[model samples]
Target: MLNIALFGPPGAGKGTQSKMLIEKYNLAYISTGDILRGEIAEGTELGLQAKDIIKRGGLVPDEIIVQIMEERIQTDTEVNGFLFDGFPRTTVQAYILEGLLLKMNTKLDCMLSLEVPTDQLRNRLLDRAKKENRSDDTEEVISVRLKEYDTKTAPVANFYKEKEIYHGIDGLGGIDQIFERLTSVVDQTLQKSWINLVLLGPPGSGKGTQGRKLAEQFNLEYISTGHLMRQEIKKDTEMGQSAKTYMEKGDIVPDEIAIRLIERQIRKHPDANGFIFKGFPRTIVQAYILDGLLRKLGSVVTSSINLDVSTLESIKRLTYRGKTEGKRLYDDTDIIIHRLEQFEKRSIKVSNYYSKQDKFEIVNGLGSEEDVFKRLTDVVNKSFKKIR
Candidate 1:
């Protein structure tokens, strides 16, 4: 569900955008002022009390507003999600709303703030008053309302900002342009909400093919240790030279050296939505080192997906691949089997480590490419939903 708060001062076109969003995302619109007006028009008991307060020039109590929201939410159970507008006016109200949503077993996905200049807001309000014949929108009242919003409502933005879900949209553009920007932010936020995953498989298990495809489909960074090492070797960095020496000697690269290279790659793409880790963390030690590095960056591996393929199938695929590419490593059946054995021995401990955390999934690797991809995608989607 894509729940959001549409926030802005008066005359910021939130109403216009909210309608569009409701249509596009199938969200239930919750506007306090509209609800209050409807209740008054129907002459409900709560509305009578609110009308009396308005007649006496007194603001309605927060408790009454909260009660109204409780009733509304209880009755609106068919929405895909919600678009909240004009209710949380203070930090206190924001907290109350969050608590209410938590009790309801849902939460706000983000707060979308439409940023418009004060001068433009004032002009828009005055123009609205003339067209809509709203007496409360007079310049004097607008000034007082804007001042009140600055004092009371503006801090709600900070409340969401501290929660790391505040998205500010430039509200000084054409309707379509502003909507496009909002859509982009929403899409990016949804993509970034997914958990990072590591793809684990023996040689010829199709990890490279699936990892790259998943990265492109989900807008994730594809981190292939082999690719990174080859690039470093090409560049001839100190670490690359060390790894090259090991490769030339037909020896495995040291864990510490591999960890450093992987760490550098992660830091280089600090703002990536997340990453599809391919062909790294082949051992328990490397897995622990990777965890430490990710922890330093405020993240952790969310899952390790292992492709389960039979030894015979792996051998057949690698031999064919070697013939096509003229690669000596894959051409030797004995060497390929040895590599697979080593991978299985080391990867069993690593798999157990993640399995203890309930983050290990073994996907079948014997099928057509599209069939295998669909199975992988289903697992990934479920993981993404669980993380959110």
Candidate 2:
């Protein structure tokens, strides 16, 4: 996903542009005003504190600002990415946000600074006050807000510039004109096609959620060894019985047998928009075999997505899945913990193996299913784009 941050002084058109871009791109729209009001209405403790501060015209604390943003980032909804209308106002806030995104294995893709002259801004505020009947836009108050903006926000824009992802949009024009400038940047990004998408994370991090979203959105199909096996067992097929027998033995099924099952399923279906593989090639050797199979079939594992979760969390999620899905055979806590230990080591090798090939796009499974899935979608877009 291409995560875009819109940073500028109040009345510099971030709000106007954010709405337009969000609608056009199907991205999440986040503004300070919106978040603060939502939190206050929800009556979260943080919201209550922010409400009190806003009631007195006091600047909300940095910690509170981060707290709200942290929650917003947790939603992995259907977004091309996200638009941050007001955030990271200070250099310190920028660093804090960077750390938060880094944990999710996402980073600042681009930052836009809308530059408008002080005189025009003042006039805009005065006009807004009369038209909207907003009491906060008096001459003295508007001047104070502008000054606070200068002191608190300008440096963060400079920080993004240093990172070389900052783009300045002219805010002097009318809203249509400014929005056109922003859309040009986004259009260029989308015109670049993506060929391969690698989803990376641990179990229960919603790798599947994201994979399915991409498949649906981009007209792709997804493959999962586990899902395939279950369908076979559901049909009471011979191969399903054979596989189930080996699984019950607490032994890894032979690669030839597993691969043959997969090939037969693919031949039977024979049609897909694109394909995402899940829960196969658990080891390095399996990776080689799968790659060989895809090659023979006139394709390859274009991307390998690994869902990351803590060992403890993976166990909980797997056990939960087992209980809910009647797959209790693998739900034993001791078995899961044991598998997790091996997974920790083997997954690293799997990830590094791809990283060495520069095909890995690691994502954070730290948030709710919605949040991580959103991030995963963007990564899929970016990966296919990089190669295509």
- Work out how many backbone clashes candidate 2 has: 18
Query: In candidate 1, what are the lDDT values of residues 72-174, reduced to their tens digit?
Result: 8777765656889976878888988987775553467789989899899999999989999888778889989888877886689889889888888999989
lDDT of each: 0.81, 0.71
TM values, all candidates: 0.52, 0.53
The CA lDDT at 356 in model 2 is 54
Question: What lDDT score is found at residue 246 in candidate 2?
Answer: 58
Q: Positional deviation of 246 in candidate 1, in angstroms? A: 45
Quality of model 1 by C-alpha lDDT? 0.81
The alpha-carbon deviation from the true structure for residue 163 of candidate 2, after best TM-score superposition, in angstroms, is 0.3
